[model samples]
Target: MDSYYFDEKSKFDARDPLGILYKITFRLIQIKVIKMALIFTFFVHLIMNCLHFFEILSTFDADLLVKYGPTLFPLVYGLATIIFDLMFEKKTAIVLEETFSQMWSLDSTGSKTAKKIKKESKILIGLVVIDTILATVAIMFYLPIMEWDIDIYYAIRLFEMKFSPTMSLVFSILYYATIPVLFFSMLCTTFALFYIMSYEKFQTYAINDLLKNISIDYQKIDDWKMMRDQSYQNTMYKRLTICIQRHQLLKRMEVNINQIIFTPI
Candidate 1:
């Protein structure tokens, strides 16, 4: 923990601004509401992907496969990739907390927030373009597999299939459409993933920077180890300390205000 954080004046006092801030932060974490919500959503996405995968395998219909398979395969694979990548839950949480803090600390002046938002927005747009291209390529790879179905299904819709050339042309034209939508959906998801990866990088970078800034001699290996351990402890300890301060502040404020009102001049 930073010595400043525990200093007598800096120490969270019931009367201090930091004390109230800590309390609010603690309440948010205590309920574990955000954590629960994230877990619930992640599972829901996984279940939906599984359902899509099953639906594709269950149906032999070309139309159904063409309509659904493209999205379903990627959906399952993408969610699986994200889930696996997020195995480090503790580190991911730290990233989210850091992201939240960064956003919360942003100054509206000089378009700082705006610039950040714009940059993120561009990344999102790029993500959409990339995922769409990927899914579209996937669709094309599956097209050859659909050739046999056309022979059988064409007979049933022969008159409609008579427009086969037109349909083919149209399908080619609209092929790009499916991907853009998929791309956008995937892009939104990437934001969360990006934050997770980014936060871990930030933590590692901060630690490395700290080590470099300390012009320590080679004999001070223990000091370096202590610095690293201290950094990790500070992350957890600060949050807990904030919680404690919040509770203390609330109790102290009530008592102090009551004493002042009751005491003689």
Candidate 2:
């Protein structure tokens, strides 16, 4: 009885449940990141639209400013989130799983394709840095803008400019409170993105190893088959040779017996 599990081939390490959970959590985070990114983008767009409606941001090429403020940031965030998900969650995950199974084999010839994917991490990292900087700048400007007393600045103050100090204080407090939550949400998104990108490296390595493993397994099977065929052929040849030699000897014996019986008498 073979105790080894031939059918399953590889057994995942039982001690790595935490790691597995972590990976799964990261994937879920990816999903949430996209959702939150869209939500934040919508909020920004709404703010921009409101500013435009109030003519607060209408002085400088209204169309272009609106396009940039309300449209561009959201567009960029949504697109980046989508692209990241496509790469990590969809393509990279499949490739990694397959690669993992392959690498589980002891023998492998490694692939370079995965290496190419890993080399793009620099680009991903660069994007992350740029986005972070942009987000920071946006938030910095947004905070002052939201808090500013436009009535005082423009002096065209509407009569009903009942800027409630209490409301302002309340909003300020709420903003501070939500800032942490927002930061946490963004942190989760960032971490998720980083993990996915990082896992890409692992995936590439795993895949290359898997290719090697499959190659080795196939070669081994082919070699065994060739040896088996040669062995069968050798056995058959030897048996045929013995049969032929025995037949020849029997014929010779029959001839001798006939010759003896026909003696010159």
- Pick the TM-score winner: 2
Per-model TM values vs. the true structure: 0.29, 0.37
1-265: candidate 1 lDDT, tens digit per residue:
1111221122212322122222322223234544454344456545545554564578655675565554456655544433433343333334334334422121221243334444554564466457657766765653434544343222213324445777855643343333333333344345444533432333333333333332322234575576677665565465445435533443443354345323433
What lDDT is reached at residue 7 by model 1? 19
Instruction: Sum up the clashes in candidate 2.
Output: 3
Which ten contiguous residues of candidate 1 have the minimum total lDDT? 1-10
Error of 1 at 97 (Å): 5.2
- Candidate 1 off by > 4 Å: 1-72, 75-179, 215-265
The lDDT for every candidate, in the order shown, is 0.41, 0.42
Across residues 1-265, which tens digit of lDDT does each residue of candidate 2 receive? 1121122244333222124333543455457655565455445434434554466445555554444454335433543443344333444444434433422221111434333444554455566668667776755543435544332222112212444666655644443333333433454446454544454344334443443343232344565675668665564455445334433433443354335324423
